[model samples]
Target: MIKDIIANTTNIKLTVIIRRALQGVASNNNPYLTLILQDNTGIINARLWDVSATDIEALVAGQVVTISANSLLYNNELQLKINDYQVLSGKEAEKHYQNLVISAPINVEKEWKDLLKTVEDFDDAILKKVVLHLLKQNEKDFTTRPAAVRMHHNVRSGLLWHTATMLKTAKEIVKVYHDREINQDLLYAGVIMHDFGKIWELSSQLITNFTLQGNMQGHIVLGSEQIGLACRTLKINEQEPIILLLQHLVLASHGKYEFGSPVLPKVLEAEILHQLDNLDAKITIIDDALKPLNSGMATNRLLALEGRIFYKHEGEKKKK
Candidate 1:
């Protein structure tokens, strides 16, 4: 199974059909192929050598193809080396592999309505407008964008799920310190809009990838620029209330320089938002990493999640 290919060191002997070909150029070389193939278990990465000149042209993105690959470790991660592959252009491949992808099983419309209801609870009009505008701009992405490329919340509507959870947590904390005069408007806006820039920063295909903007300026600068445009178009007085309300203490959500935040969390609400966002993201990483099994032991090497090792926690046993 494809899951075994990712989990163990056994040579990949399974039959998988290529579902998508991600466009990428090797360092100082011509464009190579990064094929995303799928079996009943999950998707696996298959690297094709010299694909630029081969009949790989027929195997376009979303085209299923038969492949024979050897699994090996690259950069301490499992990767498949495609020895031979062919495009299955006829209707046979579709009937064989259409049910392999494990996508979101919940009702998308219900989740969206629930998200809107959560936002309506906030009593700040300016913050509400900012969020509404962002939602309007990415009506499709908010519901379809993955929270990450390959880590926690990397599913349909995953970004919205994470954002809604953070808002809920922020509300509870903000209520505890009622006298801080902490601008709930700004904090709420920042929490919702912080990663909204990623919608543009990432390519929203089946495989989420960093766009040119993401590779160059990264999400923080891109997000800040987007905020600037929104503020300008809406004619919000950004110098005083708008900047104070919209600006995050740490420019990036991570709260540190290395993680991409231009400014560290300094303001009261910005700091709080940073912590809340971090807490939610990390917990999600652990949750997703441990979701597959029910017992024994498993150590997940989460590169995108945190480049760290994670061990699943066994539930408590009943005392009879």
Candidate 2:
């Protein structure tokens, strides 16, 4: 199994999906390929040195292939040195494809149902209509798609998991700040809509990739545009302050311009949604990084967190 083949494993043959493949030239000017391989268990980096042009051409992302590789530690993380690899075909490829996609840890169906219930229970009629309309329109992909190609919550049904968790967090936060002039309805709606563009941004394949629109427009722009379309479809008043506020929530979700947000969070609700979105995404990254480590060990540098290393304490207790 992919999980069992770790550092020190040598000459192991495995059937895997090519999550990513990039062609490069070595220091000696020899052609090579850097690959991110995946299976149902997890993903790992692999290098193919001195590869032929034909090999480079054939190794496409999302293709199934069998490889013989030696597992070793590089930069404190498990990496594979590919001895040889071949693209699989026919029934062989199909069989491996069925078993190679990883999914969200939570029950997707349950979370989806709970998400719908939350939307339906919203006290604000306009927010309720806007959110429900979008959810219903993209129901299948919304529930099944990964939140990203390869970032926080990038598993099957991860969009649902990420959105649901944010909604739950927003609910608790609004209650604590009940005295503050917070709009609970907007908070809930923003949380649901913040990453809605990812449904169009990413492919729903086993090894997710950016769609053409995703590459060109990204999630923020696409999300904002989506909100605009939904508003127009519902015949929502253009003069309504809520319409602009909702658009701001999606546009400024990244919190700042350098981080890809076209605008910064201007309203209190948008700001809170931005912070909550960052918090949930970061926590998920930390959790995923620590899962493969034993107690008292430090994780390999996390690429998602700017190469920060996290330690797992033996008696560490989760925050309540």
Candidate 3:
């Protein structure tokens, strides 16, 4: 398995899925291929030196392949130095493909049911209808797609896990702010709709990648467009206060223009939704980075977290 391959390993032969493949030019102007490979356990980068055009054509993304390589530490990260590789065929490829796709470590059906219930519990009719409509329409993809290509919650059913955790967190936050002027239903709807476009933005395949729409429009713009369509189908008035506010939540979920948000959060609900979204993503990244480390050890710099290193406290108790 990918997790068991470390710096000391040699003469490694494994069946793995090609997550990504990119062609590059070496210093001497020779063509090479850089591949991101994955199994059910984890992902790693591999370099194939002095590659020909025929080799590049054969190494397609999302295909299963058998490879010979050696593990080595490069810049404090483990990478593979590939000597040779071949795309698998027949029963061997099929068998490896079935086992190589990683998924969320939770019961997807249960989490999906919980998500439906959360939407159903919304007291505002408009909010409830909007959220439920989108979920039901995209349920299959929403329940199975990854939240990202290489960031936090990038595994299968990861979108659901990310949504479920955010919903739970939002519910608690609403209770604390209940005494204030906070609109609980708007918050609920906002939380549910924030990443709704990801269903179309990301592929649900074992090796996830961006769709054409994802690269062109992005999740924030795409999600806002989805909300608008749902509103129109439901006969939601364009002039209604909720319409613009809900769209704002989706548009501003990323919190800033530099972060891909078209606009910064103006309303209180949008601000809260953005904060909660960021908080959950950051926590998940840290948790994932610390998983393989012993207590008191610091994880390698996480690229997603702007190259930040996190430490696992020795005295901190872990959940079962």
lDDT of each: 0.69, 0.87, 0.87
Steric collisions counted per model: 0, 0, 0
Which tens-of-lDDT digit does each residue in 1-320 have in candidate 3? Answer: 88888785789998899989999999999999999998989888999999998999999798899899999987656789899888887787887886898888889999889888987987788778888998999898898888989888899888888988898998898888778778888887888889888988986666788899998988888888888898889998755788788999999999988999989999999999999999999998898777756688787888878898988898878878
RMSD, one per candidate, in order: 5.7, 2.3, 2.2
Descending-lDDT candidate ranking: 2, 3, 1
| Candidate ranking (TM-score, best to worst) | 2, 3, 1
CA lDDT of 70 in candidate 3?
A: 93
Candidate 1 local lDDT, residue 74? 62
Window of ten residues with lowest summed lDDT in model 3: 288-297
Error of 3 at 248 (Å): 1.3
Q: In model 2, what is the error at residue 218, expressed in angstroms?
A: 2.0
Better of 1 and 3 by TM-score: 3
Which candidate would rank higher by lDDT, 1 or 2? 2
User: How high is the lDDT of residue 175 in model 2?
Assistant: 86
**What's the TM-score of each model vs. the native?**
0.71, 0.93, 0.91
lDDT of 2 by residue, 1-320 (tens): 67887689889998899989998899999999999998989888899999887988889898899999999988667889999888998787998787898888888788888888988988888888988999999999998898987778888889989999998899898889889989888888888889999988997767788999999999888988887888899998755788788889999889989999999999999999999999999999999888766688888878868988999998877656
Stretches of candidate 2 above 4 Å error?
303-306, 317-320
Model 1 lDDT tens row, 138-225:
7788777767766566665677777778877877878888878787767777887777777877777654678997888876677777
| Model 3 whole-model lDDT (C-alpha atoms) | 0.87
